[model samples]
Target: MSRQLLQEPVQDLLDALTKSEGPDILSTFTTSPKPLAHEHGLPQLAPFLGRSFHGQEGISAYFDLLSTYLQIENMKFEPEETWVIDESCMAIALRGTATFTWKETQHSWEETFAYRIKVAEDVSDDSEKNGSLKVCEYQIWADTGAAYLASLGNLDDMPE
Candidate 1:
């Protein structure tokens, strides 16, 4: 597939999340009963923060955890680099910025993200088809200290 075609699903997912459309966000995944891994790379701030999730259930749990602290108004993802690993796989390096209400205080954050996505084959059987291109792995690296302080509504402690 072309790069533009490969990027469409990812862009769709980002758009849905930016709009806070939960159902649309969830539809970008495959329902193959396989495990999907998502890792958040901030741990020192909150105990429940920066956890790794697996499978659809784990994905739902991760979203639930995020909803408690983050009321995101907008999330914009810009692909800084992209590499096609093969016909069925691709990796995208993204720089993302978001404006959100965290812990009742509005804040904005910028992060570097990486996504490894796999394009599912079009099989005849519904059960056999894995659906569309789905994000198999997502990793985020951000300023943990700032995000931590924001989560506590302590803007004064945040670095300049």
Candidate 2:
């Protein structure tokens, strides 16, 4: 029932990722163009560079660029919130799923990532954009599902 036990599956991966602030995350990748991108630190993206691919690389790249453009000030995990620890130490990945979609608006992109956050309250409906989900980044990063859970309880100013 501990945090470590619950994070067993994506514990190391997500932990390593989340530990780095968004600005730090941007610096590491933006300057390099290609670095330890995957969970295993693989350089497989170079070969597929000129080619077209729709995966984490593109999305991560977009985030990096967006972070740079926004001049993000700070990035930190929700400190005071309660993490959904598992009932047992030897349980599966105590994480949920998320989906993101973006569309080209008049002058910029309108992006939204829907999530199924596991909060203390029954907020399945509150995760929607119109609900209690706190949006970020000129409302471009408006998340409605697990993203809300991932970003829960964090009180940093908008990244701008």
**Which runs in model 2 stand beyond 4 Å of their true positions?**
5-54, 85-160
Judged by lDDT, which candidate is best? Answer: 1
Off by over 4 Å in 1: 20-23, 33-37, 79-88, 104-131
TM-score of each: 0.71, 0.26
RMSD of each: 3.8, 17.1
Which tens-of-lDDT digit does each residue in 1-160 have in candidate 1?
6766667666665666776554464555555544354545556775445777665677667677778776655566664254434444555555666655566666555544444555343332465444456555555565566667777778665567
**Model 1's TM-score against the true structure:** 0.71
Root-mean-square deviation of candidate 1: 3.8
The clash number for model 2 is 4
| TM-score leader | 1
